[model samples]
Target: MAATLQLNTTKWSLNSNQSDVLIKARHSIIAYISGSLNKFKGSIDMQNNEVEDACIEFNLDVKNQESTLKNIDSPLYINDYLDSNTFPNITFKSTSFQKISSNINFLKGNLTVNNITKTVELDAQLINITIQNGTKTAIFEISGLIKRNDFDLVANAYNHTNGISLGQDITLTANLEFVI
Candidate 1:
């Protein structure tokens, strides 16, 4: 069956404009500050504008996660942090999406990382649905905040010299392009 999107279905992908994944301490010795990995790969399972019954999932390559001081791809497999060898990928599955205000929607889902699963709620706005070049594409902007410690990312290296944080708060912004 062909895709039932608002436009001609073609290729779709996920992109992020700004993502701040940081870990800091009270004394202000920052452990790490990552701008964006830009290595996230995922798909949207759209059955039209209704995402209520849809199953959306994403897999983030841990090895590609970068920081202000370095590229910690290899370190992701280490014992202190992500431990990508055992976990491999960070993932999320949407449970539901709800329309609240006229231009606001809430996406509720479970995010799994480092063998820990946590519920995350994201606020999103459907930017526009436009048809161009015989293809219909839907653009959306999403934002959210999460605690790294909640996902067991407990490397507090900035705190105790071996510890990485007072707490790590991750702020994310994503731009998704989809074909209907």
Candidate 2:
């Protein structure tokens, strides 16, 4: 039998809070801003002695982007830094999965934003797979970090503000769900 497509919609969250805004201030006053993945799709396959192929997709909606501090995000959202009006979404599509073992795998794919495409690799592990109500399901906990500047997500920078600096290097942490 062929592997089944298990995921209807998976989640990938981007945290702006982790970004540091470096401004000249007596101390840093930066906090975390967060956003959700409004458009995402992926599938999971488990069969035979090994897992089958898989794919994942992601889309970023600028208007949907939100942050902890309204002052920080509203202006930044409108700036040339993000340029949401021009480029509405950032996207990712997985090409393939190379399973290393029963538990670990490598998810390799292309990520695109602002018309730039880059190769990305993610280390994914199967936390558990379960069967309930005549359906099979899989859950994976994924964690990785990507450079924000690589995709040119930098915006609303400051010269001096408290001790906070708008910094790059965003961390991606997520719990995914799928069913077949």
Candidate 3:
């Protein structure tokens, strides 16, 4: 008689200490600006060791972002695009997480930024799953490009006056680590 193996579903909380949410955008014609969000929380549910049908959620603190050009005294700041004072947080709630290949998955969800909500899709790649010190950890890299104008992240008067035009496409990358 053959035995059927039943896998249990596990809920994992994000390890913020080991995770990072980053953004990159083209600054002017030949430069790029990058920043990192320092505060965020997220969770994932894994069933049968698969990302398919998993529920994922993330909340990022926009006000806590660390700019790489902080010392440059640039006219353009994160506030020019994100307006963190007005929209303190950016959030994502997944509607679907589907595995397309052995290590690749597609995550579709509602992304709320600057008080505007839009449907976004990100490519998720399972980096590794490890068991260490009697604990299970899973790591994933999620990346996608979103239009700034779609979320009302347009250039401000100050930016326009300085002839600094940011790229319409903003690249978002999140390196998330989950522990069970």
Candidate 4:
């Protein structure tokens, strides 16, 4: 039987320095832009070396995102887009997980942005699992895609007609590490 190793606050801490949340989108109808959120908190629970019954929760601060284009960063924090002042944080809570391979799982969860909640499924692959210093660490690579309009992030809704706006779909990527 597989050994069950559970994660608890005392054993697990989301390593910000080792984890990152990134978003990519098409910009100006001709280019692509990417950004990373600088602040977030996450919790994870792993069961029997699998994600079948695991629980994961993450909360990301919108105002702290950094993008390659410094000028565009400010706009994302305003009401025209992310509206960081009003809806300061975006969140995700996993509902379930399904194993696809020895190193991969499908993660289904609820994603909330700007007070709007939607379901998202991500392809998560376990990069590595190790035990060191009396702590067990699990590293994963996660990715997904979603339509901005679905979350009401319609700052460029009208600009789309002009062929000079952002793309409706965004790609999300993350390297997550959970320690226990």
Candidate 5:
């Protein structure tokens, strides 16, 4: 039997320097672009190196996103996009976990954006877990896909002429580091 690593604390937080959430989508008829949420916060609970019965929450600051494409970055703060002034935060809260292995799991959660909430599943990987200097840290790689239309983010809906047609599918990935 494999040894279970006990949780040093029931609470953990995201290390900003080591954690980030990135999103990718088709920019036009021929290219894909990527952007990242510059600010976010997370909290989770675990008892045995597994988030078996805890709610994992991540709150993202949508106003501070960064992307190389100016056309894509500028509209993200307006009413048709994220509406940063109104819906400044995008969030996710885990409801359950489907364990595939000791290091792999599918987290089912509610992802909320633009005041709309939808159920989404995140493929999660336990990249590393270690204890050093009397502190415990865990790193996770998570990815998922969602439709921007579902959240009413249709800023580029009719802008094909500008060579900017944002795709409906948005792929989100994150390397989250949690410490306790």
Candidate 6:
């Protein structure tokens, strides 16, 4: 008699304390400014220990961002740029998650920001997976580029001649940890 292996779907929750979500954009056409989104929640559904048919959903608190730019008070102000007062959340729901290689995957989803929804594709890399104390944990790094103008994330009354013009392209990177 041959033994058959049973594969079941598992749901994983994001460990926000062990994760980091960052955004980088060009500042004044020379320097760059970076910021971190501190509060977020997400989940992943995996079957047979693979990401080929995984479903990912994430939500970020726009009002909880922290900037890394120094000497400036309220760098990338929430109301000035993101208008967090109107839209307090940035959300993503994956339509498909395809594995390209053993560690590389492509994630296509609808990203909603500032009340605008757009389809975006991001690169996902499996960093590591570990089993500790009968718990399964997985770490992944997700990254991609998005345009600020596409989502109306630009400030209307900003002075451009003062060497403070923000760039259109914004790079987003998230190091996410999930536990099952």
Per lDDT, the best of the predicted structures is 3
Q: Which residue pairs overlap in candidate 5's backbone?
A: none
Tens digits of lDDT, candidate 2, 1-180: 999886434422222222121111112222222323245567666564235656666565544545232333222222234445667665668888888887788888887756678888877766666678985666664445566577776532554323234445545444555565
Candidate 3 per-residue lDDT over residues 61-144, each given as its tens digit: 655546332413355555666666899777877788878877778988899989999999999887888999999999877889
Error of 4 at 55 (Å): 1.7
TM, every model? 0.57, 0.60, 0.75, 0.65, 0.66, 0.70
Over 64-121, each residue of candidate 5 has an lDDT whose tens digit, in order, gives 4463323344333233345556787778877887877776789888999888999999
Worst 10 residues of 5 by lDDT: 28-37
Q: Which stretches of candidate 4 lie over 4 Å from their true place?
A: 1-13, 28-53, 64-81, 130-136, 155-164
Q: Candidate 1 residues 36-90, lDDT tens each?
A: 5533443444344533222345555545545343423222223344556677666
Ranking by TM-score: 3, 6, 5, 4, 2, 1
Clashes of each: 10, 22, 0, 0, 0, 0
Where in model 3 is the C-alpha error above 4 Å? 7-9, 28-42, 45-50, 65-75, 155-158
Structure candidate 1, residue pairs in collision: 5-180, 7-136, 8-136, 155-164, 156-163, 156-164, 156-165, 157-163, 157-164, 158-164
- lDDT (CA) per prediction: 0.54, 0.52, 0.70, 0.64, 0.65, 0.68
lDDT of 4: 0.64
- Flag regions of model 1 displaced more than 4 Å: 1-55, 64-86, 159-167
Query: In candidate 4, what are the lDDT values of residues 79-173, reduced to their tens digit?
Result: 33454467877788888877877677788999988889999998887677799998788887677887788888874654433444566776777
Q: After superposition, how far is residue 93 of candidate 5 from its true place, in Å?
A: 0.9
The TM-score that candidate 4 achieves is 0.65
- List the candidate 6 regions with Cα displacement exceeding 4 Å: 1-11, 28-50, 64-75, 155-163
Candidate 5 yields a Cα-based lDDT of 0.65
